[model samples]
Target: MKSSRSITTILLVTLFLAFFLGSASAQEPVELQWLLIKFWPEYDDPSLLVIIDGELATPGSELRIPLPADAELNAVATAESSGRLLVNDWREETTADGKRILVFSPQFPVFRVEYYTPLAINGDQRIVDFELPAGYLSTNEANIEALLPPSSKDIELDPPADEQGPTQDEVHLFQRTVGEVKDQAIRQKITYVNASGALTVPETASSSGALLQPTPPPAEETQDKTATGITGNPWILLLGVAALLLIVGGAVGLWLTRETDENEALPAASPAPKIKRKKRSASTTIRASQSNLDRYCRNCGREFGPDDRYCRYCGAKRQTVP
Candidate 1:
């Protein structure tokens, strides 16, 4: 009985440890948010711009993402949010078709990685089509969005329900949630027009001119219409003339009143005071110099009365010159 009880105790402890370990693993499982792919085509060059943005859960700084083997990496950047690149340590390694890995160790647990390549050529039918990376778990339930460039006027997007058919910028959107699927495919075809078939500036200008051309009536017909309108509504013509006259009269009255008020408000300019000078005799000039009017403080540099003892400005003693 003792041995049996010991065995039972060991079994119970083992089961408990297994349960705890399983729960811990569950908690550490990765969570993927979204994968966005974008394509921009260049008319001058046959190449297209391919950009990818992916967000996933990472308990630690390390994260691994699989991409297509043929994908070209131009610039690789990571961020905590969209459009903002964060500092991270990253490297790329070629894997089998099942996995082409882009490994990153970001600063944060939740990381977004965006990278772009400008030299992806279209396959047959002038269409650039491919499947996304594999090894993504369906349980993560990640969302996906694919954008196609403007060069392709005639474009087709799969899973039409999720298709936001060509936007004004000519980019198409394939936005949807990744379900229990292992791989996602994106296909795009570009339709081109020859130079001769393309619209010319002169052609467009001619069409615009057609719209601007006006159909004017003959001078005689226009004169007859004007005469008939005036005769038919004599009262209206008179009313208009009367309104014009009233407006003119009111304007004239306003001008006259304003002028009269202005004239009345201003004081008649008095003849600028006649600064008449009387001829001064020599004796008057001699008497003026005898008075204190010519006295000035030497120390303070101010004029003062002749009886002052100290300069008012500087408090200096004043001396009378003999």
Candidate 2:
């Protein structure tokens, strides 16, 4: 009887341990491929954007993300295959240790979360203390980036960033990369001095209630257009118009010159023919006037024949005159 009781107790304990281990394994946190964290303070309050890319063992499984206690979630979404984010339904919960967490079931593997919290601002100086949530796990690569305010200067970072540079929009950026980030909370500190309270993000973007959406980088064609002043510069348009007018004027002038040259190379034209008039015969004119002549010569009173060479009376010779 004693042996049977001991064997039954052993069997019960083993079954209990097996069940507990199975449940724990099934509930293990999913490992992430990478986590990107961005700190932006261009609003009334500072904000953070977190993007997680990972594959779940089971699709449509529940995911729990830890955030700052004072964080107010702005947007929660999952990325589609087309790179479009579809907003997801999420709920906020608190753990026994007073840590705030967001719970959601993402339909896709990649997800995004955005939240805003207050910053530590003292006069002209601003400070940001950001850390990844302990609930998340990343493989080996993690990235943190902070966007400095417009017109800000005297930037400093704790455990200095790997890269610091200005973006095309003239916005300053500080970025850090860490390896083997798994389950550990990656923390960063950024400090900057800004006398002017100007905002880097456009007012329309913030007022439209979608400040958390990732702004796509400016297209290359758009930059080209801007550089050529095709969209905004009046001088460019004016110059283009002037150039076109010059080209048209030159073409017309060339055509006219070519026509003039062709005309000059042609042969001269011939003159018109002259009109003719009728002529009278001399014999007819003489016969018509013969009847009107005198019958005797004035010098010797001699008779003249029709074809007289000289008068014959002067020399005692016959003579005919007309």
Candidate 3:
């Protein structure tokens, strides 16, 4: 009875395991659309930028996307639906011919990842040729679209001109349909002239276009002077005006000084008014003589007492002067 019970349990577990495995394998792969924009610098090789937009019918714990062999893995980022960047749990491996493979296992249902790959310049024209990898486990309907930089002119695609999509940003669009995910050898090749001949490097390899450094106007043409004296530093003009103002002010001050000297003569100093003194009469000039002075001692020229016969100061005999 125990042996029979054990056999029944084994059959039940096997059936459950089989059912789970079948359901997981049957899940449909996500639909993927890859938009790649190749930005060409005036000089140096062009850079390839990629944007991936897709929908997953079966949300899985991890996701994987194939990148170009020469991709810069450090520049990889996963973005949310609202365009906010989410933490990426990803790693990369170098492949043959300096190409790289980026693997990301994002936890989101819908996400976007962007990165760049350096392109090679072959012959005179810049070229981008690559094979798309099939990383999806299950079958998926996928499409690939490529945009050349706006400055790119004389662009040519691998799939004849008729097979190309509409022109956008002055460059023809190249698209390929990879219906149902399989190890199909999907390929893309593009050729174009680097519009500026790579004379100047691009500041940004943006999808819209590369932001180029403006070419300076020709030296000979730019040398022409304008009617207004507004060339060069404006501070120089200000300094000239200030100097003119100072010169005019000095002239005005000198003129004012000259006019003041000429119009108003300094008063000639009059000999301080002669002080008038009245002539004195004889009676006013004469003063009454003292009687003691009249009776002065002759030997010492000292005044004597009223009845003393000798001067007390010199002890000489007193003599009268008439």
| Tens-place lDDT digits, model 2, residues 1-322 | 4434544555555556555554554324556666677778754344433334444445677777777777666677787877777777665554435565566788787777777677778898888887665545545666777787668899898869899889887888888887676566778888888787776765545422543453333356654454344333434544555555555555655666677768777897777777676666898787665544445554686766666655657543332343
Candidate 3 lDDT, 61-105, residue by residue in tens: 455456664554323344566755454555543332333444456
Q: What lDDT score goes with residue 91 in model 1?
A: 56
Q: Per-candidate TM vs. native?
A: 0.39, 0.54, 0.42
| Full-model lDDT, candidate 1 | 0.47
Identify the candidate with maximal TM-score: 2
Predicted candidate 1 versus true structure: per-residue lDDT over 1-322, tens digit per residue? 4434544555555556555554553312234554455544342233444555555544453555555555544444455544455545555543222334565565654444433334433342234454553443223444455554443444454443264566665544556654543444333333332222222222232211332221222356544443345432334455555555555555655666677678878998888887889989999988777555336676767876557777788877666642
Candidate lDDT (C-alpha), each: 0.47, 0.63, 0.51
Best-performing candidate as measured by lDDT = 2
The residue ranges of model 3 lying beyond 4 angstroms of the native Cα positions read 1-45, 66-69, 79-87, 93-100, 135-139, 160-172, 198-201, 205-322
User: What is the alpha-carbon lDDT of model 2 when measured against the actual structure?
Assistant: 0.63
